[model samples]
Target: MSDNKSNLTEYLTPLIPLAPVLSVKSLSFVTSKTKKQQSILGCSNKLQLTSGRAAIAIALEHAGIAKNDEVLVPAYHCESMISPVHWRNATPVFYKININTSINVDNIILNITPKTKAIIVTHYFGFLQELTSIRAVCNEHNIILIEDCAHAFFGSLNNQVVGSIGDYAIASSMKFFPCYDGGILASSTRPLGNVNLKKPTLIFQIKAFFNIIERAIYYKRFGIAGKGINALLKVKEWLWNNIKSVSGEHYTCNSPASSDGGYGLEEDWIHKSTSVASNLIIKQSNTKLIIEKRVENYQKIHEALSGLTTAHPLFTKIENGFVPLVFPLYVDAPEQSFDVLKKQGIPIWRFGEYLDKQITEAFCPNSTALSAHVFQFPCHQELTNQELNWMIITIKKTIK
Candidate 1:
């Protein structure tokens, strides 16, 4: 019996997801009349692209930013955020972020110069960046303000939704919602221009649908059934690889590359529109319920970890109407904790790992520390109380 208990504890559990993908049953109820969909469409001249990077590329092009122009970007960011600037042949100037992950406006102003054309501010981990001062500075300098709301699709500040605040804003719907692929670009002052985007190939659409189905199965099945599903997935991969090798076709089975810098922009996919199935998934989702549940889960974890000495949550309190994308914890040894949680099969992520190596500690010390130390846990609406408790207890045991 003791051996059985040891084995069970060692057995890797599947990841607890941050969002719930759409199930087939939910598809029947999809409609365009939901308040969320209406609000998203009404924001401005909107363009839906294959991914957030694509949206940024389009926004830069439409704004008349040309090669050799400088665009200020927060140092603490994913490579995808920086990749679009390269795609446009624009230079990226890194700015420091404060302890709360908001941009230091002083650093931004210092970085701006005659060649500066735009500034991109990110609402890190869904906490709103205080944008009024930054906007004023941008206005003073005649620099375009672009809000990176990739982590803040539904978040609002002072009653204005994230995408509405900047001269141009972009978001990754896949982060906040269950859609397989989506990117949104919105502007208050100008049209998005006539971007000729072709529909994604049928093969791409089918692959996306299957990916969502696989996530659904992972969420629903357990024990032998779950193991069986995983085994089947492996076999499918093997078969697909063989098919690709024999067919002598370069057809890839996954969604388009999201952040290849500027390498593959000539491909038909760079101008691809969001999938119809993705649109349907978002149209049918309950925006209010999603926000409330995410807040509840985040607060529950925050309260549980408040007094712990081994690790500290980045945000201790949840503000009204703020929906968190993840619960970020700053720990003493991030690499060790990440390995422990990963071994236990907890779905965890660290965006710091994906930061471009070109960004040095000298350029942005605070962002460097955050990149190395902050670990993000799943706090999306999909997690139940029991799962949240497991994650909290696991961290308490491992971090010390």
Candidate 2:
């Protein structure tokens, strides 16, 4: 049992712990300071929700889309992105994404029908989609445009931020910032009138605060004493499991129920505002510094992986003013490579792999290939140079 436990400890690194939570002092400072200037898209009258999916649900409700109305979504997407449409009893039209993860404009136009009420354009992996062309198509067809910037919190294209491009845009603030939970629903033309979201319960807020603290400690100590920390976490997990066996509580400390993705917007939480902790952290964070560090990390990985025989980066260059969420690499044997990384406890993500079968069939061959091949590596602000170097080296070795 001890040997098995030791072996398990080798594969227990926390996934993507870059965004550090703010301290109470920092939160107080942030709240006391003057509000930051708004982007080209005004910042007033924004509605915050429990998660990005909730934001989408509100946007759909605001657009007045009803049952039998269709909303076009990319085939290369997570379940959370499409689930809201289904929850509304509306049909979802899945469009194909090209090799670069951008929507095939032609395919999207082809998929549009008279019943289509709205089109969701996602800026996948923080790379901007060709919004100009898509926007024109939406106008011509009289369809509402909802830009999904969940992966792109603060990036710009042609001097305009992504959220400004669509009629209504939704972003997952928790993805980019060190927040326990947050989602923003903003509009370009009009104010998002009272969403009626309530404040998160005090218990929920307390759990979030402690989760953030645990994440911070894990990240701060990983570089110095990763093995020791991981061992302790394993012991805790074991003790918790034994307790659960005796009490039949089934409680897990690793991932809480609140952290799970929502299939539909709950009436209780859909109107709930972003947690105070999340709002304060976002207000306190240095946007410029976060963008620069992420860009820098992405470039470093790109330089290292370029021209490799076994794998190559999807988007070869980072455009000006773009802040990437991850460094996407297309490996020849993604399954094998992924397994190798998993054993070593390296954090990697593969979107679109677990998509619905109907979506996979409707989309093009490119979507299928991308789903099987692409792996998203960490390029966030918290990673040390040494960690980045180690990741690059491990990826090269794994792919080869």
Candidate 1 off by > 4 Å:
1-14, 23-34, 37-42, 221-254, 259-268
| Model 1 per-residue lDDT tens digits across residues 173-270 | 77766777788888877776777778888887877766765776777624357667778888988998899899988875555665211223434455
Q: What's the CA error at residue 158 for candidate 1, in Å? A: 1.7
The numbered model that scores best in TM-score is: 1
lDDT of 2 by residue, 15-61 (tens): 43434334333233232222332232254457777677778888998
**Against the true structure, what is each candidate's TM-score?**
0.85, 0.83
Model 2 RMSD in angstroms: 6.0
Looking at model 2, report the run of 10 residues with the lowest lDDT sum. 1-10
Residue range with the least summed lDDT across 10 consecutive positions in model 1: 1-10
Q: Could you list the CA RMSD of all candidates, in the order they appear?
A: 6.2, 6.0
Give every collision pair in model 2: 197-271, 197-272, 198-271, 198-272
